[model samples]
Target chain A: MLGLAAVPLIADVIDEPFYTVMFSRMLILSIGAISLNLILGFGGMVSFGHAVYMGIGSYVVGIGTFHAIEDGISWMGNGLIHLTIAVVFSALTALFIGSISLRTRGVYFIMITLAFAQMFYFIAVGNDNYGGDDGLSLYTRSKFYNILDLSNDNSLYYLNFTLLIVFLYFSHRLINSRFGILIRGAKSNEKRMENIGFPVYRYRLVAFVIAGVICGIAGVLSANQTDFVSPAVMHWTRSGDLIIMVVLGGMGTLFGPVIGAVAFLFLEEFLSGITEFWQIIFGPMLVLIAIFGNGGIDGILVRLDKWWQIKK
Target chain B: MNWILLLEQIMNGLQLGVLLFLLAAGLTLIFGIMDLINLAHGSLYMLGAYLAATFTNWTESFFVGLLLTLPACMVLGMLLEIIAIRNIYTRSHLDQVLATFGLILFFNEFVRLLWGPIGLDIQLPEILNGSVELIFGIRYPAFRLAIIAAGIIVAILLYLLVSHTKLGMLIRAGASNRQMISALGVNINLLYTIVFGLGAALAGLAGLMAAPIMTVEIGMGEEILILTLVVIVIGGVGSIRGAFLAALLVGFIDTVGRSFLPDILGFFVTNDVADTAAPAISSMLTYVLMALILAIRPQGLFPPKGV
Candidate 1:
């Protein structure tokens, strides 16, 4: 946290301010990845359309700003309204998508989610009022008047960083709570959980919504960072990328997604720099990981910790 | 309403259905027998197109190219099953999903490297390039007509192969009870490899058929892959018969809806609203169908055995 807090100052001193901007994206996606871990890692629901919530969050901001600029709908420009609408609307969307997607288990569930996300993506691509396939741009960041100003990059970065920390604390509490235990237990053996007098479906559904809401907030931040919203925001490949982050970091561990997100960005950045066909190498690595079977980068750290303790 | 135009559209839908069936048959069988989901099934479709394009360029015959593409696809399929897929059989569904997803990345990039970023084109044979006129002056592409005919032929062949042949009996036995079949001294591992190859060959055939109409390009698999996934899901996991019916239904809904939905919606709404909603709704139609079906019958329309 101290090192992250110092990023802006360090970037300015080193005259390489792009690091602050870049880290902002990684942190936001880390939040998204973490949200996914709630269901994917702990609750045993692999939602292939997790990023659709993020896209919905973004479009809320984009549509708000669109109306604000085009029709003098100033209240739509308020960050509070943006966040509230994003939250409520995303929760509702998640409910609808989850109800349908959760009906079938295993590969069927994955396909349904992928199919539904594709539906949303196509709708965004088709809506000409929101710039069609070109996407919508924010004329100005959502405002809080005297209370906050997102127009300042530093303030925005600080706000994102603060939110990330708050989310970290909240999720930590969430996973260890009784509710969290129920959700995780359901993942282990849903039939037993149901037989033990818990309504596993409802429990899973609630977790799904909570995860969607958090990921959606990350989407809002990402849109704010880019100042644009498009169907590309929730493309299946983007969702796949999020899943990769969660898996690569460590599924059932907190902070593993953060590690995964950072590692992913680094791998993408470094490998792309080496050659354009980086997927050839990166693709096989995932296969090897899946076949070998461990938690992820966090899993590696955990094993190392055990080894060190034994040595001592 | 123009019945002739509708008929032409129905033909288009049928051709698409045939293509989907080819892919879905293999997918259903693989799932039924091996209990595997190959997300890279679509990648095989893509490779088939690329292979057909190359072979056509060499042999100067599309039919010969297609013939050549099938065996090639089977070999590639078996190789993939042996190399990458063989390792992940007992892994979790998540592992299978991600690893196959990895295969997609590898196959997509591998294609890009070998074929270049530009897409390849498959030329239709001369006789098949012209239009076939039906009754009432309705006309359709002869290539598409050939596709439907070929699909029927293959479906018949597949039916005979699965219903009568010794291999077909073994496949049925494997699908019903893997342990019993293996206990009976059948080579279970070899059966899996052969099934995977069969699935790949079918997907490749679909790809080669699709190549003439659409560009033989990278990532084309993902789009059709989603559609085929929808088909198998709606059809139930293991039943080839279910896959067949579901593929035709989805293909018709997609094609007919895309072409006529605006007009249909315009009946009850303003033209502007219809125009705006048509594309979005058309694309969503199949997914919505799947959701609704699963809601009422989560086992899908024609599930054969316990999920």
Candidate 2:
């Protein structure tokens, strides 16, 4: 948390303005990864369609503003309204999808979630009014109630950083709470948990919705950051990317996804700068990580800590 | 409704379903026996199409190009299994998913490096170039008919091989009980290699066949891969007959739904609403079907006998 708080000053000292924007994006993605970690890492639900919430979050802002502009309506200038609608819509959608999808297990669950996400992607692409396959661009950054101007890059960066820290704290609390314990227990063994009289389905469903709503907030941050929304946001590959982030950071560990988001996005930016076919290297690297990286970056850090303690 | 148009649409659906069957067959087999979800299956499909397209350009014969491509893809599949995939069979599904997802990124970029970003258009052979009359006032492309015919023949051959042959017995045995088959002194490792190779070859064939009608491009495998997953899930994983039936069902639903949904929706809604919503609804129909099927029969329509 302190490291994130120091980023702006560190960047200022280094005289790199672009660092703020890049870190802001990374923070938004970290928020999403943290939400995914709640379900995938703790709850044992491999949702291959979690990106839909992010897409929903973005489109809520994009489409709300588009319609507001078309009708000359000023109500959408409120950031709170956008945040509320995005969260509510995403939560409701998650509830509906999770209820149906949670019935199956393993690969079936993976495919169903994936298929539903694709269905939403197609719908978004078919919406010609909302820019369809082309996506929508904002006329202006979302407005606040005379509190903070999102149009300013520094304000936007701080806003994302603050929310990320807030969510991280909330996630920390949630994962250690009694509800969090049940979710984790369910992940380890569902049948046993059920045998012990825990309503695993209800717990899992709630976790799914919570994850979706949290990621939806990240989606809101992303739309403001980019000032655009497109169907591409909900693409299956995006979902895959989120899963990669969670796994890479260290599943079931708080703050691990934050590290994952920074590492992955930085590696991507660095690699793409070097070559057009960067994924050729990135792809094999993922395979190696899965094969050899014991429990992701967090696992490595833990091991290092142990080694350091032993040496001391 | 024009009968000819309807018939043509059905044929289109069949063509799609048959192609999906080829992809799904290998997928279902691999998942059934190995319990490994290979996301890179589509990568192999992409590779086959690219190789076939290049080979056809060089050999000047589509048949020779396809013949050369299949064995090469099989070899590649076995090699991939040995080098990378062997380690993951014992790991969790998440690991399998992530690793294969990586392979997808690699293969997609690799293809782009070789073929450039633009898509390739495979030329149809002279023999199957034109349309043929199928029914009253209905003409379909000869190549499409050939695809359907080939798919059916392959399905039959696959059925016969799995049911009546020594290798098929081992595969079936492996699907149900891998340990017992291995304990009996059969080479499980060699069997796995052969199975993986066969699955890869089937996916490759689907790719090559699909290339002429569709643009052969990077990431093309992924486009159809999700649909194939739906097929195997609805059909019941590990059962070829289930995959075949489900593939055709899904194919017809999707193709027919996309073609005719607007007209059907027009009966209840305004023209503009129908026009806008039809494609979305049609695209969603297969998923809706899968959800409904799964709701009633969580194991799918035709789950393997023992499983």
Candidate 3:
């Protein structure tokens, strides 16, 4: 934590603003990945529609900014309003989707979640007022004039970093709580949990909404970071990227998603630098990873720690 | 709307339905017999279109190009199975989905590298180039009619092949009991490859047929692949009969909805908003239907008998 706190300072002395921006994006994605871990890793609910929350979050902020500028809705100018509405709207959307999708199990659940995300993607594309397929661009980032200046790169980076820690700590506390335990319990054996008289559906639904709300926050930060929001964010492929991060970092681990985001985004940066057609390489690499990459980087680190402790 | 236009739109819907059936049949068969979820089945459809375009351009004949594409696509599908898909059969569904997603990326990029990012438009044969009179002073595209005719012919042939042939019996047996068929000394692996190849060929046929009507372009397979997934899901995962019925049903609802949804919504909303929202809501109708059906019957409309 201390070392991370010095990243902006070190990058500044080195005159590398790219590190600040890149790391901030990674931190935001980590929050998204972490929330995904909440349901996907613990609840065993493989939601292929997770990105919709983020997209929703982005659109709320982006569209709010658009209205704030064009229609002179000054109240919409505040980041706090964006956060409030984004969280609420995403929670309701998650509740609605999770309710219907949770009725089906296994493959059906995956498909339905994906279906809803695609449905939303098309909806986002259809709305022309918010830039639709081309995406919305913000001339100014989220404003909190007295408390925080989002225009400052370092402050924004620190803000994202702080939120990441806050969310991480919150997730860790939640996971060890009775509620999170029940969610995990349902995942391991839904039948067993139901036999014990737990309302498994309601528990999972709550977890799904929590994950959505958190991922939506990430989207707010993401829109602020990029100053752009588009329907592409709601695409199933973005959801796939989040899934890859969760799986790569090691499912069911708090810090795993952060690491997954780092590894994934960096690898993407490196590979895309090599060729515009980096997907050709990335495509087969994912196949190989799915085939051979068993325990993710976090899992490997955990295994190594156990081995070292045994040696000691 | 004019009666002629409405009838034409209905015909268009049937054309689309049969095209969907051509793809969905193969997807369902692969799932039924192999119990494999191959996302790259759409890639086969894409390859079919590209090959059809290339071969037609080469031989100066559409039929010949399409003929050549079927075998080419079958070969590609089989090879892909042997290399990539065969490894994931015993793996988890997540792994299969991810690995095939990778395949989609690779195939899309590979096609881009080979064919370039620009879309290829296939030329129609002289016989199928112009409109044909269907009734008194009403006409429709001959090629679209051909697609419908061809789709029906393939559907009937598929029925005979599945219901009557020795291979069909084995496929059914395999779908019902993989262990029993394996114990009976059937080459299950070979069966899997053949079924996958057959599925690929069907997808290819649909793509080639569609090429003249639409641009054969990069990532085109993915757009339609989701629809095929919906068709199979609504039809029931392993039922061919279900796939055909569901494909046509989805075809009519989607095409007809897009055509008329705006007008219907225009009565309720302003013209501009209706026009803007119509495409999205129309496309969403199929998924909405899927959700409604799954809510009512989680097992799908016609789940095949057995495990």
Q: What does candidate 1's lDDT look like per residue over B1-307, in tens digits?
A: 7788789889889989989999999999998888887789999999999999999999999989989999999999999999999999878878888899899999999999999999998788899999988887778889999999988888889999888999999998889999999999999999889989999999999999999999999999998998898899899988999999999999899999999999999999999999999998898899889989988888789997644
Off by over 4 Å in 3: A1-3, A305-312, B269-273
lDDT (10s digit) by residue, model 2, range B1-307 = 9788899999999999999999999999999999998999999899989988999998999999988999999999999999999888888889999999999999999999988999987877898999898877578999999999999999999999999999999999999999999999999999999999999999999999999989899889998999999999999988899999999999999999999999999999999999999877888899899989987887889999998
Of 1 and 3, the candidate ranking higher by TM-score: 1
**Poorest lDDT segment (10 consecutive residues) of candidate 1 chain A:** A145-154
Q: Can you write out model 3's per-residue Cα lDDT over B144-228, one digit (the tens) per residue?
A: 9999999999999999999999999999999999999999999999999989889999999999998999889997898898889
lDDT of each: 0.90, 0.92, 0.90
What is the lDDT, from 0 to 100, of the residue B305 in candidate 2?
95
How would the candidate models be sorted by lDDT, starting from the highest? 2, 3, 1
Q: What ordering of candidates by TM-score runs from best to worst?
A: 2, 1, 3
True contacts kept of 2: 0.79
Error of 3 at A109 (Å): 1.0
Model 2 residue B125 lDDT score:
88
Q: Between which residue pairs do clashes occur in model 1?
A: none
- Winner on lDDT (2 vs 3): 2
Of the native A-B interface contacts, what share survives in model 3? 0.67
Poorest lDDT segment (10 consecutive residues) of candidate 3 chain B: B30-39
Candidate with the greatest DockQ versus the true structure: 2
Q: What is the alpha-carbon interface RMSD for each candidate? A: 1.0, 0.9, 1.3
lDDT of 2 by residue, A142-248 (tens): 77878999988889999999899889999999999999999999999999999999999999999999999999989988999999999999999999999999999
Query: Which has the higher DockQ value, candidate number 1 or candidate number 2?
Result: 2
